[model samples]
Target chain A: MSTFIQQLANGVSLGSIYALIALGYTMVFGVLKLINFAHSDVMMVGAYVAFFVATGLNAGPDPSIASALITFLAAMAGAAALGIAIERLVYRPLRSASRLSLLIAAMGMSLLLEYGGQVVFGPQHRRVPDVITDERIVLGDLNLTVHKLIILGVSVVLMLGLHFFVNKTRTGTAMRAVSQNVDAAKLMGVNTDFIIGLTFAIGSALAGAAGLLVAFHQQGDIDPLMGVYPGLKAFVAAVLGGIGSIYGAMLGGLLIGVAETFVAAYLPSSFRDTITFSILILVLLVRPAGLLGKFKPEKV
Target chain B: MRGAAIKLGFLVVLVGAAIGIDFALREIFNPHWLRLIELAGIHVVIAVGLNLINGYCGQFSIGHAGFWAIGAYASGVLLTVAEQKWGTPSAVVEILLLVGGMAIAAILAGAAGLLVGIPSLRLRGDYLAIATLGFGEIIRNVIVNVDAIGGPRGYHGIPVYTNAAWCIIVAALAIWFSRNLVTSSFGRALVAVREDEVAAEAVGINTTRVKVIAFVVSAMMTGAAGALYAHLDGSLDPDTFKFTKSIEFIIMITVGGLGSITGAVFGAIVLTLLPELLREIHPTLSEYRMVIYSALLIVIVLVRPKGLLGNRELSPSAGIAWLRRKFGKGTA
Candidate 1:
């Protein structure tokens, strides 16, 4: 039915955002093996930056393509800088510390961003300037919107660009090498710290893009805590797709988005969160390594 | 046998003294301060239980709020039913009902812990954290869906049976249990597992069983604390048992020193009192309280990674040994 098509379209658009956020989580997790709890906060920061930029530019409800591009670019740049700073300041110093210490530090970093955001941005919701018009496009019985198209197009383009960059670029290869074996990568004269920072930068930029799109999609829904649920759900997506796998995170995000949308449509709305989490537990129980993650037997 | 009897007698005296002080303080201090002290004790119970899981067992399970919620709702439902079945009970019967409710809460929470623990047996580090996080959200969702217990709106009018004396007694018991647990051979097994899981399994430690046991015991204690919290507040809100609350408990144990019962107790009391202390100082300061709290956490981890106590118990014998070492041979 047309409703099914509409739902699928909506799910994919949501999934694209989740995929973008999950990329950051997966990439950082790949290099550092830390959960990077603050990554979600970084996404929040990105959304806020875009909000300010668009507002500063006086972009009304229907901004031009140029203005939207500038907004996205500024947000991504700001977020990337933050990511590198977090790595250098908070994480890098604790490189040799215990796992518990690292995790707690990460948590502290997350809280600092969230509460600090409340302090800086105020706790109230800010309606994002409409980057794109919310005009509906009717294709026979299917209902589509400009927001959905923009989300899909931008996400696809970015994902393709990222895929090529990670697969083909020398810097990306060096990044992969560091993730596999830090010492080995260092031995090969790779600047491991720089690569790690670069990983954070790239991952955070993706999250920034995701944040901007989400803000645009859910006009007037931007807030300090907006990233928490999406961040968590995206994390579940990363895990479901087998964390550390780029393609897996993408796959997982889409699957979760579709499943969540379908569940919301069919079941009592309250069960939406429960179902998402249930999938995570089920995946973890069945395949602890995640969908795309390889199982490594522990060495004594 | 004499040593066991002496220890028992000492605990009994300590508890009796606490109860006496609690009553005396009520007559002297304002209700506000008294409530803070009671809440501090409750936090101690939860913190100690969390330490047993995260610190001793080396399993980072952050779904503690789920267990706490379970205990609170269970106690709330029971007390509500009891009040309906038999109007207001006599003083003695009221005490019995509260104790019975706590026991049931602990049992239910412990059972839920077992369910969560089995799934966690296969996970480690961040993965375990995520699964536990998921379980916590699931619990909150389930609570919201159940219409009988007020669901999202939360339960109200639970009997107020919790007090400073009750809180102190339970907190003392929690500390005692954790101390005994960490010092025993089983405790050694847990430490071994924390240090290295594969090595512990190689040395014949049933890692799975140890983890599950830790989860059950920790959940049980937290559940009891939840019951006390319910009775103290006379209400239950599902929102109270969110991931953020679990993070608060984790922060307490981390600040106090993981795997140290005394550290957990110390951390719990200090943290519970901190917000109140800030509020007393100034409203603006309290507004930025969480920021300060988080910064302190980072600084502590950066400075003393093992936490303040660093897996060391704070006891008289240890204090004496420390004093002797510090002051050369003459101090003893």
Candidate 2:
């Protein structure tokens, strides 16, 4: 029972990170209908930014709350800038192009960032400065680490903030309108480009936050290609929860995280990565529309 | 009848020329480039095969590497066993056994294609792309886990049976096979499916059958190419056949021109030679080669949209017209 509870806690922490990243993927796919393959790379960028900010500031593992906040905000700002730049420079011009063209361009941006990041960042493992000193917190049979609790807590706060922003804010409403019907939203005097850019910004900020959280939790284990697996798994999570649905992405992330954790605990650990792709194939075969996604009618 | 005779003469000349070049590479050229040329020929087979599904049929499957891995492992395992039983038979017997191994590779790959193609029947566009991507990853993982094939450490000790001659023959056959398929009535059905699946079905085209057959054929060609690659490399590392390699094939078809056989050939050759060409420029340049490669992909899609050759095949008159369009502003 204790093992199961601890595993569950670990699963939720991991799932929260996935959920944060998946939300960004879901939003980008919602507005543009492109996979935005570079979105995951933005998570990498976010992690790197935080690493530079945190470690460059001090060599100590633990930093005060102010330094941690500064690091987090800097990563968020950096990722948002990158997100908008990619959307405006790489994706915007190809908006009216064929789906294949858009897909390829996204892939181009993905490759550009990955290799370019490797070039600029000098592909090597860099440790993220720990913002908080972790302590063991025991509750009943559950063994919870302080960083893990912080991850879960921070993720919930950001998720709630995003939910409220999307549901209530005027700009967020414009984003929804554009997603529903771009032309209609344009005619209604909504600045479509600005909204799209804002969507990218907000989504990327969340990913940045997730990146920092994972960094702190993993004791500064960050690298250039670190985002590839999480990025892909988050994508699979987005797809599993009807892609355009925000809550669906969150739910899907949690489910995949828990499932992966349970599988690893019961089965050989090598199967951990394989389980994500297997679930992807199964979901695609069973429900391409996803759990919460409404089936779209094919236009003749 | 006279035209038929001329066409037959052209094909014979083409094969003879290919064989002549192969022998030249064997006897004359620096042996270093011989390896590159052989690898280029192998990629040509893969590019043509991929074009059958992605370009001609209009399906967006990017799992070419999965079939390539299958073919490599199949060939590697078979050749290893065969060598254990009969150590390096006569040259003629060796070629025959290699051909036999290639056939087995193709069959295994084709079966995998069939399994992947079934889900494709129910999906289209990006969904299909994701499915194929998943299939490729699954194949890689399965191979990584299975220990009899040496698992993740990769299979070694395979002899070098693939050479310039074998590569040329395989590439030539693949080029001709795809060219014929693209011009045939069945090929038109594939184009129809790509254009509009509903319309194709409405016109009595069995879109599913066309998709499945195209996928199977594409897989077989990639598998054969994989066999060549395995023998050339003399060892097979499972990680070498990852998503990146598959994307390279996609880049070839996209850069060449989807749905154009000649375009597939052009893409395969240019892309295969691109890194080699870049290496001559500088070592650092080669490191940033993918950056330039991907940037070109974006630029080409933005400029031509259709591709370098677009839907048009490379012919003398067509080439002249294209040059004129590029250079001649309005008619003189």
The number of the candidate with the highest lDDT is 1
Residue-level lDDT of model 2, residues A29-48, one tens digit each, is 88988788888889899999
* Tens-digit lDDT string for candidate 2 (B1-332): 99899978987887688778888877887887898888889989999999999888878876789999999999989998889898878888888878988999999999989888877566665777777777898889888988999899999988778888788888888988898898899989999998898899899998888999999999999998888888997899998999878888988988999888788888988887788788898878888888887888888877887789888898899889889989897775
Give the C-alpha miss distance for residue A240 in model 2, angstroms.
1.2
Q: What DockQ would you assign to candidate 2?
A: 0.64
Q: What is candidate 1's lDDT per residue for A1-300, written digit by digit as tens?
A: 778887898889999999999999999888888888899999999999999999998877558888889989988998898999999998999999977788889889988899999999999999878866678899998888888898899889989999998889999899889888899999999999999999999999988888888887786479888888999999999999988889999999998988888888888988889889999999988997788888777665
TM-score against native, each model: 0.97, 0.94
What are the per-model DockQ values? 0.81, 0.64
> What DockQ does candidate 1 have relative to the true complex?
0.81
Which pairs of residues clash in candidate 2, taking residues 3 or more apart in a chain or in different chains?
none
